[model samples]
Target: MTAIILAGGKSRRMGFNKAFLPYGDKTFIEHQIARLNKIFDEIILSANDARLYAHLNLPIVSDILPERGPLSGICAGLIRSTSFHSFVIACDMPFIHEKIILYLREQIGGYDVVVPQTSRGLEPLHAFYSRNCIQPMYRCLNEGRLRIIDFFSEVKVKIVDEQEFKELDVPTQPLVNLNTPEEYQKYCDYKAPNQRES
Candidate 1:
C-alpha cells in the first residue's frame, strides 16, 4: 500500500509550517515518513508547495482542485496512487500510531474508506481511502461539498470505534494533532530528552 501525507495545509492556526516543525527526533513530516516506511514502500506527499518538500525525494502532488482543503489533497493522492488503496495521514498529527494504521489496513477488505471514530469524531485524515473513491470525492469537491464525510454516504465506510483505537494505540495518544502554538509546545515538551535523531 502507498502512504499519502497531506502537507499542504496553510497552518493558519499554528501560525507557521507545522510540517517542518521538529518532533521527537525529526521534523513532523520526517517522523510520519519514518513510521510509515516500515509498512509501505511507496510514500507520496500531497502539497501545493512542491519546492518545500523537494529534498524528501518522493513523489509530490499538488491538488488538482486548488484551495479545496484536505479533500482536494485526498483526491490528488488517490488519483496518483498506484495501489488500490492508500493510507492517508495529515502532517500535523505527530502521534499517529503504527499499530492503528496496520489494524486499519487489515480492515480495508471491501470498503472505500476505513476511518476511525473517536470522541474526537471521524478521522478521515488518518484513514485508508481506496482509489475507488476518486469519483465520489471529485463529485464532492466539484459540488463545493468540501467536508470529507459528506461523500461517505455514496461509498462503503468502516468506522473503527474509540475502544478499538484505544486498544491499538499503546501510548494512548494517537490522533493528537498540533493545530496551535500551545499544543505544539506541549507536544515538544512531552518528548523525552533522550529522543535524539537516529
Candidate 2:
C-alpha cells in the first residue's frame, strides 16, 4: 500500500513555512518523506505546490482544495492513490513510529480508516483513509465543516487503543506537534545531533 504525507499547511503558528524547518541537515518534509519511503510501496506527497516535494523523487500531488485544511489534502490523496486505502501523516510530527504504523495498516484490511486513540484524542493525521472517505469529505467541505473530524460518521473507523500502540519498540509521543517557533526549537534540541544528520 501507499502512504500520503500532508505537507501543505500554511504554518501560521510556526511563523514560517513548516515544511522548510530543519530537522537536522534536511527540511522537515525531507525527513518525513524519507521515513515513509522505507515502508510503503509508494510514498505520495500532498502539498500546495507539487514541485516542493519533487526533490524526494516520488509521486507528489497538489491539494484538491487549497487552504481548506487537512480534508483537502486527504481528498487529494484519496483521488490519487492507487490503493483502496492509504496511510497519512502530518509533516510536523517528527516522532512517528514505524512499528505502530505497520500495526495500524495490519488492522486496515476490513476498515476504511485505522486511527489511533491517545490520551489527547484520536490521531486522524496518522491514520489510514479509504476511497470511501472522498464523498463524505466533499460533503463536509460543501457544508463548511473542513475539520478532519467532520466525516468520522461516514466511514468504518478502527480506533487502535493506547495499549495497541504500546507494542511499538519505542514509546512514541503521538501528538508532539511543532506548530510554533518555541516548539520547533525544543524538538531541534531534543533530537540527538547525529540523528537527523541526513
Candidate 3:
C-alpha cells in the first residue's frame, strides 16, 4: 500500500505552513514521513507546488484539478499511486498512530474506503482509499462538489466508529490535528512535559 500526504492547503488559519511546524525533534511533515516510512514502501506527497517539498525526495504529485481542496489532492494522489490502495492523511496530523494505520489497512478488504468516524464526524483525510474511489472523486471534482465525503455514497464505505476504536485499544488522539496557532501551542506545551520526562 502507498501512503499519501496532503500538504497543499493554503493554511490561511495557521498563518504559515503547518507541515513545517515544529513537533518534538522533527517538523510535522518530517515526523509523518518517519512514521509512515515504517509501514509503506511507497509514499506520495500531494502538494500544489512540488518545489516546496522537493527536498523531501519522495514522489510529489500536484493536484490534477488545482485549488479544489483535499478532494483534488486525494484524486491526484490516487492517480499517481503505484499500489491499488493508499492511505491518505493531511500534513498537520502528527499524532496518527502506526497501529491505527495497520488497523485501517486490515479493514479495507471488500471496501473502497475505510474511514473513521469521530464525534466530530467523518475524518476523510485520515482514511484509506482504493483505486475504486478515483472515478467518483473525479465526478465530485468536475461537479464542483469539493467536500471530501461527497462521493462516499458512490463507494463501499466502512466507517470505523469510536466504540470500535475503544475495543481495539486505539487511542483517538491520533485523529487530532493542529489547525491554529493556539492548538499548535497547546501541542507544544503538552509535549514539553513529556519531552522533559524522557
State every prediction's TM-score relative to the real structure: 0.93, 0.90, 0.94
> Across residues 13-114, which tens digit of lDDT does each residue of candidate 3 receive?
999999999887888899889889889989999998889999999999999798799999999999999999899999989886877888889998899999
Cα lDDT tens digits, model 1, 1-198, are 899999999999999999999986689999888878888979999999999999999999999799899999999998999899999999998775667788889999899999988778988888999988899999999999999998999999999886875565355456677899998887765542212334
lDDT against true structure, model 3: 0.88
lDDT, residue 195, model 1? 28
lDDT of 2 by residue, 131-198 (tens): 99999998888788988988989888889887765555446553466889988877775552224444
Give the per-residue Cα lDDT of candidate 2 at 74: 86
Error of 3 at 53 (Å): 0.6
Model 1 residue 87 distance off true place after TM-score fit, in angstroms: 0.4
- Taken over the whole model, the C-alpha lDDT of each candidate is 0.86, 0.80, 0.88
Model 2 TM-score? 0.90
